[model samples]
Target: IDPRKTETAEIASAHHFIVPGSDAYLLLAMLQLMFERDWVNAGHLAPLLQGVETVRELVAPFTLALAQERTGISAAVIEAMTEKLVQTPRAVFYGRMGVSVQEYGALCQWAIQLINLLAGNVDVVGGALVPNSAAGYVKPGERGAGHFNRFQSRVSGLPEFGGELPATVMAEEMLTPGEGQIRAMLTLAGNPVLSAPSGQQLDQAFEGLDFMVSMDIYINETTRHADYILPPTSALEHDHYDFAFHRLAVRNTARYNEPVFEPEAGALHDWEILNQLSQKLGDHKGIDVKMFPAPSAIVDQSLQQGPYGKHNQRGDDALDLAALREHPHGIDLGPLTPSLPQRLCNEEKNIRLVWQGIADDIERLRIASPPQQQGKLLLIGRRHVRSNNSWMHNSHRLVKGKPRWRCLMNSKDMHEHKLADGDDIVISSRAGEVQTEVEQSDDVMPGVVCLPHGWG
Candidate 1:
């Protein structure tokens, strides 16, 4: 379910057109039905589940009619979807990037997981089983309490997740001067001016910094303001590892990618440049980059310390960098097996359905007014096939055709606004405005429009 008919929707057997930021409400309504109809089947999970009663109470006020009013979807459709989820054992609820970045993102994500738990679709085959990842975090009886709202940002008082504050608050933190004010800035691997919410605001905030440095290969929008740019080896010149992605899979696999090209003499990789910077910053006399371990050495040591590693010895045969290198196509360790109470992160070894901090937002959702879409169209962001989030568009072969950045508007809205297909218009929000050409299409939901990312 999404605000737009995305490419994924084209292949889906059905698509549910939900309002831009009302996903949490729809999810709560479905959950309400699950409780009222006695459809929740957490058979084996009963002993390990907590807060079932609290979650039921939390969602009680959100009815199908209320959800229909907030979301553009119908009450009957909501009921049918809930029934399907409870009846299908293999069906799981997953929230993606779009929902996770909305105003009610945290609530929507929590609701989705709670729904999956109630449906008994977790940890079983074809369900939501956790992978036996390269890391040892998912072992039985291990505490996996991933950090959340542990601390707040200095200026906005916004909560930090995993030690980093939200990018939305970056400009404000830099622009608002006082104690702990930001005077110098450093950027790595991102062009926030084009990819972040308040692109123009961030661009202005960069102007006031005393010094700024960027670590990137291309001098794009955000990096253009930096006092210095540290160029690194291109993609082909670096060894590759999927440190961020393998943990999300259902099958455990490992692959080490060798660099495609030899590095030019005296050309430093990213880590090498950072090591040199560190030495200079610390004023360490005679410290050399040779003192540090190479990136591959660190990876190799980490692999040996993993569950299948010879040093770890948690499993039978030894698996390490050598084992991975023996098979070029990549070796599948095994399918993810069920790891329940052992995988629970809490001291009690249970999964709590209700988090009071997140549940508190349910009431705010109950009374919140539907978005005002009368004189305005909500803007949604999309990525072009030829470009990633602010990357890969520099290649002429990928950008040789017509301009990929255009405001996609529903044809009905174009008719009411008296706009031709190719008319140039200025799109405005409180943060900033951009003038771009409009393309009429039925793919976008009415009262909503889209713009492609990665374009300056």
Candidate 2:
């Protein structure tokens, strides 16, 4: 189910248009129904899972009637969707950024995983399974509980997660005056001025930085403020490997791509620039800056030491850098199979279904009411296949045809405002306002509007 009649919804077997930011209520109602009807796979999940009862108790109040009232979806449709999920042999509920940018995003994500686990779909064929990469990159070891809150931001007191602060508070950390205030900033391949929540505030904060460096290919909105801009070699001039994406792929596969063309005379690779900067800072103890003179050597070492490497005892079936280089196309490692329970990397080797952070967020969801819909229209961001943010706007091949940047509004709302298609209108929010062209269509739900992201 989606709020917009997107291309995805057009081809769906069923489409249920839900109210904006009410995903948690709908998911909770489904879980409550599963618990009431005993449709959960209790035997298979009992040994590897925890906090089943806690989730059950927490979702006890989200009945179908209440869910319909909040989500604007009918009770019968919810029941049918729940029935299909329980009866289907393999089903997965994938929630993306739309569910993750709202107030109860954390709770909504937890509920999606809980539904997959309870339905016995985790790690099963055509189900939600953990992706395996041939590169043998094991999950990092767990840390003590105290490690999480060891340091908090000086300005907001927000605790760091995994030794890093959220980017949302970066402007505040720089703007606020204190002993630990950020004065110097280094940005790499990020246009925070357009992507951040408050573009104007970040633009102002960047101006006040004592020293600023941006490592990017283009002098876009954010990089224009940097004191020094370092341009790196283009994609065609770099050897490539899908190091991170392979860990999230549906099937196991490996490929290596040599540079298609040589880089310009003085252009430096991203890693080379970073290595030089590290040397200047006098902290190159364990890096061995000279060991791998080129990036291709690093890829070779990783492939030689990976899970499917020639070092394994699988005889001729094992693969190595030489074999991959010879193939040139790719080496397919076959489809996804069951690798649960043993694949889990927790200290206890079991799923901790009840996280304290998520449990606390559930309380916030329980008492939360949907925002009142009156004259105000809820604005959400969208993207198109032809665009990859502000970076791709310069390519004439992608930006040719017609302009795609406009305020998408519902036909009913456009009629009420006496606005026609392609008319210029002003969109205002607490942060700022922008004047843009409007297009009236019924694709979006009433009382809702859409704007494309990364537009300058």
* Best TM-score among the predictions, by candidate number: 1
Model 1 lDDT per residue over 9-57, tens place: 9998999878788888898998899999998877677789888888889
lDDT of 2 by residue, 267-363 (tens): 8999899878877665546543442256666666666666676654657877766778887888888887777676666668788888788777777
TM-scores for all candidates: the values are 0.94, 0.93
TM-score of model number 1:
0.94
Write down the lDDT of every candidate, Cα atoms only: 0.83, 0.82
- Best by the lDDT measure: 1
Error of 2 at 408 (Å): 1.3
Model 1: pairs clashing at backbone N, Cα or C within 3 Å: 140-342, 141-342, 144-345
Candidate 1's C-alpha lDDT?
Answer: 0.83
